[model samples]
Target: MMATAVVLDPAVTMRTPEWLFLSTGIRAVDHAVEDICSVTGNVFSEGASMQALRLLSRGLLGAKARPEDPAPRLDCLTGAWMSMVGSQSGVEKGASHGIGHALGGTAGMPHGYTSCVMLPVVLRYNQPVNAAQQAMVSEALGQPGTPAADLVAGLVAELGLPGRLRDCGVKREQLDMIAEAAMHDRWIPTNPRPLDLAGVRALLEEAW
Candidate 1:
């Protein structure tokens, strides 16, 4: 019998990337985590998000940026919830992640690369949720007044990332499974709106 081997890299290997992320400020990380949690029903809150960002920024941005003033404990919980909402919106709007995930394994791409590619599409898909948020997103991207989806689409294009799952090597037969997996994921619960398998399938199909 042949045995498969598992290997783990030392913790030090992660130090650099972690530091880099911290350097970028915790608010960014909070955004990433919250986006993941929001759509997926993951545990997160905006206040907690602020706390983590504060702690991380203290090191990266400076001690002055640290969260010296503490928020109420419940604020952390609310932040956590907000984080989930943010994460869900990220995934739901573009459907680009599905492509990125498929491409990651097939093309040896990194997680950030995929996310950069897909964020716009997800924002576009969820445009109906709220125009204010969409407008804010556009402003953040430096393309104010642009529709959120279009703004993101432009960003994705500028990044030179693949826009389709088929281009990334996903098969038609796999769509059903991927859609099912996404809908049932823990993050699904945190999504601003409930998503069904069919909705997930449609997103996948659109991406393809």
Candidate 2:
């Protein structure tokens, strides 16, 4: 969604409230994943990304606690829109999205489920390069001082979403192919740290 928005209008800039209300559901999930691994130096974009995650966490939790309430639903939608606010036309997504595309395109995994399983592992793998950002992510998700990966995994579990690649029917044998494909994904170049086949494979192994 952010990718499409960037392509359609590179000059686009979301308003503050607009961003807070825009990110939700799977779109919020995508934003959170992308921000964690992004190398872009834009502070506003990074801050918005973290806020999107925080909003998403609140929205999801509210929705879970009161399924009949419409407020949480609206919050989620707003969060989704905000999540994509700073995405630029030429900027690529990071490893979670890149790997997710490979998994979805090659392995036929559902997009949301792909994120559910891969995001935590991607965060953990990229932590060395982006520990501060990851810490922000953890705080946004309401888990200060905890490993971002575990906090993310906990969120997935709380949402009753798949938390492991194997749980989503991803076979161990397919990791190599997925890793190879991820290495070539456009998003790989924009990852916070360099990504090689070996590193990609290691991330995949952890996801598996």
Candidate 3:
């Protein structure tokens, strides 16, 4: 059942540890990136996705630079909410979200951490097909001309979050299983860049 209304309060989120907050904030960043780059995306979702990136990047970095302040988390919340708007509009996410699910299911990784590692890898893999769209993502993240993948990795690094599969303790042997599982995810087919099983495996290897 869908809720008729939703409410968000940044005050209630302060109790969460800083590291965890930063990790999930990256997941919100991943959402915006995926929404803007999805094969079926439109201008309405692109607008919201760009705004989400703007707010998340500023707010997440602000929190990293000033952990003593609680104000930036409100920006994060608003940005995350904007991401939900794009998602709810049926703008499908791509291989990043798909591979992230495989990591969660096959290796017990959190969606946030998986996003940190996989979003960059997936963006790089898709870049050849979607460079123009990705340029917009990098610009929204405050770094035009930088690869969107590098910008995301840099943002994750600034937050002191883990940025690799090794950092999350996933073993190399698991890459094959994760890749196989990722192929079955609904979002994989919707990726802006077409991905067969080999492409999925290549992405996992890069992340690993």
Candidate 4:
């Protein structure tokens, strides 16, 4: 009921289709539409980000009940966070989230689970672009002493998330399409680096 209510809220209603479709087989243009619907329709920004962060903080640090699980809130909040992260870093479509979408769709893993697991890898991959940003991410995760990239990996392990795409039931052959689709995602603009289809494909292969 809580998730249903949350999804039906004006902020989230607009982005629902996009989240539903960016799967192992969905086309890139469709993914773009999803992103557009999400940002323009819901128009989540700084305010939404703050609310989400508050909810997330309470969920992660203050409570363990179903209401505070963080998973449902994450679907909306994390995307908003990434959009903000994209804005702040001047990088669009940043990191392993695209990869996580593919793996999550193919494996029945939730989006938050995918994000939690794959972000560390992307954070590491993008480290050369901004050590400071990565460090901030490390600190946010409460792993201040760990290397930014490795901190993500360590956090994923500690969180009991999937460590590899293969572990999530992704096939060897599907990596190409996943990478290709990810490259076309509008979020691509937020990435720290300009990832081509080939580059995304390579990352998929490596993750595979």
Candidate 5:
């Protein structure tokens, strides 16, 4: 059962380390983006997800520039919360999340860092299946007409986060194992773009 109440105290997290804070912010972005792109998402969830992205982008950049400030921390927390609105309503994520879970189990990659490296790649991989939904993601990130994958990749670069599997120290050989494990993730079957083991391995190769 879920808790009766939850409180958000951004002040308590105001001092979160920059690396953890930013990568997790990307994780929040991943949540919002995937929900917006999910095949089952509705107008309501997409709306919340869109707003979450806007808030996260501002808050992340704001906190990066001024870690001593509390206001941006509030924005980040609120954005993260807003990002999860879909989870409660039954919107499922896609390959980005599925693959991320495997990368975590196999390479011990931080959850947030996995999003940093995989989100953009997965976005590109799924773009063909959901180009219209993906465009909405770009608009939410305040980058109209820019491919969502490129915009997200740019954001990762802006945060000084690694965007490739190799940069995260998953040796070239590990991609195959990660793919094998990712095939079983609950999120895998729901990915907007259908995927097989070969497809999953291809994505890992491209991300590498």
Candidate 6:
């Protein structure tokens, strides 16, 4: 989910709030329950991904409030679609996803759950190199003043999602293996910041 939002072209301007309102209409229909409840499945330029993030944030918050509302549901779906626009256009997933792939494969965690646990930690770790981009992420999530990592953590909490590596049965000892495996992931090269085994270890430790 974070990968989806992080990969868009930041140059594109989108009135995400407007889209949310237009899609939901005035029916008070509960699309949130209809959409967010479903499980599903990127990366690319920061510009497009930022717009997608804004859409996703609004959609998610709205859906959380009115799970049964169609407007927010539509917004969530569209936001999801937009999130992957970067990957489709030639962008790759970054460290958050690369590490997630490692966690899911080695730790036997679910793909969706991996993001819930790793994204916040990875975002914080990468902020030194991508503070501007991370700020856009915070804004898109509708918490411009908040740290992006904190906002992501809050979102996971609100969704009743797991927020810790330990919650998924990942052991402290497994951190080394996960980091090594993540170093080999294809997406690692695309991470906003250059990554090494030591960096990966630190990220895993934080997530754990």
lDDT values of the candidates? 0.44, 0.71, 0.89, 0.47, 0.93, 0.61
RMSD of each: 10.9, 6.7, 1.2, 9.0, 1.0, 10.7
- Would you give me the overall lDDT of model 4? 0.47
- TM-scores, all models, native as reference: 0.51, 0.82, 0.96, 0.57, 0.97, 0.73
TM-score of 2: 0.82
Order of models, best lDDT first: 5, 3, 2, 6, 4, 1
Span of ten consecutive residues with least summed lDDT in model 2: 6-15
Model 6 segments more than 4 A misplaced: 1-47
* Candidate number of the best TM-score: 5
**Superposed model 3: Cα runs more than 4 Å off:** none
Error of 1 at 176 (Å): 0.3
lDDT of 2 by residue, 1-208 (tens): 3343322221232232322222225446666557644776467667677777887788777766765566766667666666775564233568888898899888888777777777777777788888887877777777889998887777777777777789889999999998888877888777777888898898888888
Candidate that beats the other on TM-score, 1 or 2, i.e. the better one: 2
lDDT of 3 by residue, 63-171 (tens): 7787667688788988988887667888899999999999999999987999899999999989999999999998998889999999999888878888889889899
Clashes of each: 30, 13, 0, 10, 0, 23
Better of 1 and 4 by TM-score: 4
**What residue runs in model 5 are displaced by over 4 Å at the alpha carbon?**
none
TM-score of 4: 0.57
Model 1 residue 204 CA deviation in Å: 0.5
For model 5 the local lDDT of residue 106 reads 93
Local accuracy of candidate 5 as per-residue lDDT tens digits, 1-208 = 3557868787788667889999999999999999999989988899999999999999999888888888888888999989998988899999999999999999998999999999999999999899999999999989899999999999999988999888888999998899999999999999999999999999999999
Among residues 3 or more apart in sequence or in different chains, the pairs in candidate 4 whose N, CA or C atoms overlap within 3 Å are 91-190, 91-191, 92-189, 92-190, 92-191, 93-187, 93-188, 93-190, 93-191, 94-191
lDDT tens per residue, model 1, 1-208: 2226433222322334532232222233325433432343223433343344333323332322332323322232233233334344333422444444544554554554444434554555566654555564454345678775674444344434455666656677877766665654554444454557787676667767
